[model samples]
Target chain A: MIILGVDPGLTRCGVGVIEAGAYRRLSFIHVDVVRSDPKSPQDRRLLTIYDGLAAKLDEFAPDVVSIERVFAQENRNTVLGTAQAAGMAMLAAAQRNIPVALHTPTESKMAITGNGKAEKIQMERMVARILNLNTLPKPADAADALAIAICHALRPAGAIQGGEREEHLTAAQRQWAKAAQKASRGRTQGRAM
Target chain B: MIILGVDPGLTRCGVGVIEAGAYRRLSFIHVDVVRSDPKSPQDRRLLTIYDGLAAKLDEFAPDVVSIERVFAQENRNTVLGTAQAAGMAMLAAAQRNIPVALHTPTESKMAITGNGKAEKIQMERMVARILNLNTLPKPADAADALAIAICHALRPAGAIQGGEREEHLTAAQRQWAKAAQKASRGRTQGRAM
Candidate 1:
């Protein structure tokens, strides 16, 4: 299965693509960072992030998209922009009917280094080792993106799918879907995992 | 001048439109709430909000779009969603090449009721009085949207314009533009107010 991972940010969003094969062997497909001028209008910066993710989604068409879930406890100066970028990534994936899975920083770190509080360099080293690469993923964000993708690939089945109905989802996901249906009563289009 | 104001939220996004006439008179144009189920997938909820705002932007073609500026200090559980909603509002207006203005909740309250820390009921009543309406605007969120629009109308001219060149902006805005231009060095499109 192919997975596209996004480390979302307005100025420098990181995207990584990887494939998981038989016996859990992984192969790297692509990695890159999208940049936007921070001093530009907030809307303009947002458009850059959105358009970048949309292009990546179209080009890769991965089986699943994994994104780092942003927390409000992050730096106050950057949390809003990060959340906006992440939102655009999710929207791009949904538009293509690709399933999405969100992994927190801790979860990704745990999956990659077996330590929730692992240092950045350690995590990068682990990523390099996992992919058998001689060099580390240059920018920190790109390495983080690959880590998130690996986390999703290693996680058990549970994710948000585009236009999915409750009956096809697991119990926990179904409960949430049922609550959504109950609130909308009749007009909601459809829910996800 | 026509202004569109958005009190952005995922579950109940409030949108309001108003016209500024001669002698500083303000006339109400429209007000409504767009809701998406919270239990639905984050992407689906965001799409609903984005589509709703896009429809309004196309229909009104407002001269300015005023959105509430969200802070990370907001309730931890809701800040991310609120920021995403506000980002979508900005995106919708930007897509139409309309100028976007951001106002804090304090600013909106001060404009409507002359008190930055006024209560919701007070602000709603002031909004009704300003619009010469006998009935209070239903739903607090809708009233807040109208208050934000009024705040933009009453403030001096200064805003984020769509695709504006650095030369056309004020000195304060120009500083930011120059910084962005310096960063991009060559390839950035145009910036805004």
Candidate 2:
């Protein structure tokens, strides 16, 4: 199965594609970053991302797309931009009728490095090792994208088919799930106020 | 001059169009709300907003587009969704090369009701009075959209032309600007960490 992974951001979005063979073998296909100028208007910046991702989707034509699910971040503006960028990635995939799977940062880390709390450098090294690349991918975002792709490749069967309705989750996945649920509750309470 | 105002949201996005005629006379052109199902996947919901706003832009063909500037809301999920929806509106406008203007909620309230902290009902009443509508626009989102359009109509000259580079601002505007600056700073700091 072919897979595309996206690490979404307005300033610098990461896009990576990989082909998964039988018995969990993986081959790197492409890796790149989509960047928008900060000086441009917000709308123009977002359009750059939207158009860039759409073109990548057409070129790669992956069977499935996996993106990092957004979590509450310390920076409101950054998080907002990240969410919008993620939305654009999902839209591009959906427009092409590609199924999308969302994975948390911890889940990707665990899949790549066997540690949910693995550091960035560890994750990068593992991604390089798994893809059999001689060197690490330049720019952390690119490595992160590869990690997301690897996560989807190693996920339990039928995870992507379920579409946000996973029937089973590992202990680490359940922990992140609980955190997501709590965060959602906090949002509802905020609306009431 | 023709103007389009958007009140961006995930569940319900409001869109309003108005024509500013000679002698400052305002004529209502259109008003409606675009909705997306909450149960749908996040990508589909965003596409709904994107397609809906794209259709509105094509139909109205307004000279300029005005959208509500998002603030740091207590509800993270809602705010994230709102930001993505607003991005869609901006993308639609930018694709058509229409100049885009952003007005804060307080700014719109002050422009419509002469009070920065006006209640919803008061703002709705003033919007109806300003638009010469016998009945208030259905759904609070529609009314909010109208208020944004009116605010753009009566704003100081050259504001939209400046494109986020306004040289001068009122005290209230400066206050909001400061808050936005602080938020940006927080984002950069988060990125460093």
Candidate 3:
């Protein structure tokens, strides 16, 4: 399954595309940041975002889109613009008949890293390892977008997201546990390189 | 000059159009409330707003658009959706190369009723009187939208919006005051009927 992730912001939005393969192996297809000029008027800025997202949707044709769900409580100054940018991303995905899923930042972090409170550097390293990249995804926002896509890809099949606790994993999900152990071991080996 | 005013909301976005003539005379061209089902996914709802605003921008081809400037500090629950809808409206206007102006609720209310804190009924009555409507504009959002357009129309030439207080009106804008007085008198007569 293909997943497109979006970390939305008015000034800079991040996008990443990946394909989840058998045994939950994830491969990176693309990662980049979409930017708008702060000097431009608000309308133009929003159009840039919408147009960029739409173009990517056409190019990637991902099966599903994952967006970082932002809370207004995060920052008073930027929440409105962030929400607007997120809205544009959502519209771009929906117009193409693609299903969109929103994951909180914490949820994405926990999926990418075992810790919900994983720091940025840790996240970049984990994302790099999972996608088997030679270098880390740069500019934070792009890395976060890729992480969100992975979060959606990691969502349990036919099970609700944000609800399943690790301890309560179903018998079939124990397979996921085994795979996660392998990924963790891979991370340990990757640190040496 | 034709002005389109949008009062943005997720469930219901209000749109109003007006023609501003010589001597600051105003006439209503259209008023509507675009709605999206709350039951629909968030992405679909945003798409509905974007499509609706785009259609209006094409149909009216307004010289300018005036959208209510929402603050994140207003209502935490709805402000995000409101900002997103406002972004859609702004994008529609910008895509058509029509300038977009944002008017705060206080500015719009002050323009319509001479009271920045005017109540909904007062704003509706004043908007009806200014536009020479037969009856009050139904739905507070639609009325607020018309009021925002009037606020934009009433904006002084080359004067910055949300600044330059009434006490500091230039000699030219004093003409707007006279026209405002005429509108106020019209409101009194409208009240009798």
Candidate 4:
């Protein structure tokens, strides 16, 4: 499966994709959406992000998209920008009908490293090691994007492709997919009813 | 005076400088830092950002460095990466003792266009028109960086430098500088104080 990991931002978005299997293929792309003109309305910033990301999605078509989940910060302004960037990524994935998985910082770190609270240096080292690259990825943004994709690759296959909806399923696969489907239904019904 | 505008990232930091007055000069330099090894640590990423940016600052010896401020978003991941990118810019400028000036989207737009809310196409057109370039700046990031420096040039002398000081008084001639400084104060103080 082809998985695209996104590091969304108002000014720049980092994207990396990895194909699952022993001989995996990887591609890294960074999209910069220069913020809208100050003379323009605030809403235009969103549009700029939208258009920029859409162009990127068009260029890199992937089966799955993984984005880092939002984390709390002290700055409201920073949080707002993060939200806008995340929203843009979600919109892109939804528009393309691509399944998306949100990976937390800790989850990505733990997957890359043995520890969840791994320092930036540690995570970079682990990412480089996992990818069998000669040097660490330059620009932490790119590394983080790659790391998110790595995290998704390590997830259960059913969690990603909707286990129940699979056209063909082994007996064991069906058991897991059925349970997952039931759980999803229970959560949805819990919310609806 | 020549002002170098840098968009610092680990992989690629867009560099552009513009000098005004009797002899006008405009050049766009792209610095690419790629680590072939995936297992490298995150500190290595920052180091690459530092080494690449420092070389440019030395080679160009810009009078001032104008940069884009890091704004937050809903995606904690993007915020972290952009913050790192902005931090790299700040460190590179501060290391050279090259006065740093930050321009917001609005101020940059206003300087390029009469309105703060001008569209990206409008700002790109204006950047090309004002600079008398035959074509639009390739890679919007480069254009945005140049636009920022152009904005700085149009502002009153010493506006950006003076505004860097927290206790400074605003100068009417540098309204954009004053406003940008005021907005950046909260984040700047965290680093300075």
Give the CAPRI class of candidate 1. Answer: acceptable
The worst-scoring run of ten residues by lDDT in candidate 4 chain A lies at A184-193
Docking class of predicted structure 4: incorrect
lDDT of each: 0.76, 0.79, 0.80, 0.60
Model 1: number of clashes? 1
- Give candidate 1's error at residue A119 in angstroms: 1.5
Estimated TM-score for each candidate: 0.80, 0.85, 0.85, 0.44
lDDT of 1 by residue, A147-168 (tens): 8888777653333333765466
lDDT of 4 at B10: 37
Interface RMSD of each: 7.9, 6.0, 14.6, 14.9
Q: For model 3, how does the per-residue alpha-carbon lDDT over B16-78 read when each residue is reduced to its tens digit?
A: 999999999999999999899977888999989989989988999999999888765564566
Candidate 4 lDDT by residue in tens digits, A1-193: 7777877665566677666676443433332232434343223444565566667667778787887765444354545455446555665666567766776665676556646668998888877777767788866667888888887776436644663456566554454445445444533332100
Question: For residues B164-186, could you state the per-residue lDDT of candidate 4 as single tens digits?
Answer: 54345344435555555555575
Q: Give all candidate RMSDs, comma-separated.
A: 9.2, 4.9, 9.8, 14.9
Clashes of 4: 34
- Model 1 accuracy (lDDT, Cα): 0.76
> Candidate 2 docking category?
acceptable
DockQ for all candidate structures vs. native: 0.25, 0.37, 0.29, 0.04
Give the per-residue lDDT of model 3 (tens digit) for A163-192.
566667765454445444443353334210
Candidate 2 lDDT for residue B95:
86
TM-score of 3: 0.85
| Model 2: colliding residue pairs | none
Where does model 3 exceed 4 Å of error?
A158-193, B161-193
